[model samples]
Target: MLVDVRNFHITGKEFERRLDEVQITVNKNSVPNDTEKPFVTSGIRVGTPSATSRGFKEPEMAKIARWMGEAARDFDGSAAQVKAEVNALCEAFPIYQ
Candidate 1:
């Protein structure tokens, strides 16, 4: 998933504020990082293919989505618990031998 910050018409300060809302392990990059464009981007990119390939199913995905949504709305730096949960989940289904 990709969130285009430009569409929000938010100032830099607002961007900063919004940044604190998420604690998900997503990659945040500027415009150039997105597609080699000259414009500066305030976008967020998230991927779950790897997890899916590792055998993460719908229930796991739903949990992850909830975490992402909560993090993106009003994160309070309590993602450690969520991280632990994710780690446990991943450990339950290893991708490598």
Candidate 2:
């Protein structure tokens, strides 16, 4: 999934940083400019293979996405809350066993 950060009023890197703070992993990528230089990126790339392997269904994924958006919108105000939610979700879906 690609999350466009333009609407969030922050750069893709910034958004990715906030997600990282909340224990969400995503990549900051952008469409290359004419010179093939990534001068600015407006979107973050989110991968779901890990989550899918951990038995995360649509509902859980949706919750995660919401957490990401919340972090992007207000990391200072929501990082702790989002992190707790992420931990809870991960605990419910153990990677092993």
Candidate 3:
């Protein structure tokens, strides 16, 4: 929820010029047994510019987001799985050395 879009533009209005920027998604989730706390306990950012550059469509974004949610839910079990998944993806579609 806390992000700085300064790199996208010079001013607020300028940044608003690109609607997609506001639509980015991240991967994280939580539930307090459906408790009284904020139900919006998770967050995701899929629309970042880097995602587009890496050829991630919305579907891919959603898939990764889901994996992240699962990982967040089961920090120990899912974390290792997500890490392996990411490593595989990176090896297949390397963007950096």
- Clash count per candidate: 3, 0, 8
By summed lDDT, the worst window of 10 consecutive residues in model 2 runs over 31-40
Local distance difference test, candidate 2: 0.82
lDDT of 2 by residue, 36-59 (tens): 226457778899999999999999
Candidate 1: residue 10 Cα off by (Å): 9.5
Candidate 2: how large is its RMSD? Answer: 2.5
Off by over 4 Å in 1: 4-24, 29-40
lDDT order of candidates, top first: 2, 1, 3
Clashing pairs in 1: 21-71, 22-71, 31-41
Best by lDDT: 2
What lDDT score is found at residue 65 in candidate 3?
A: 60
lDDT of 1 by residue, 1-97 (tens): 6655555554223443443443235555454344424233466555778877888888988887776554444445645665666678777888895
Q: Write the per-residue lDDT of candidate 3 for residues 1-95, one digit (tens) a residue.
A: 32232332222232222222223234322322322223333222234566666776777667666664454344446556666666675465556
For TM-score, candidate 1 versus 2, the one ahead is: 2
Candidate 3 runs further than 4 Å off: 1-47
- The TM-score between candidate 2 and the true structure equals 0.88
lDDT of candidate 1 at residue 46, scale 0 to 100: 59
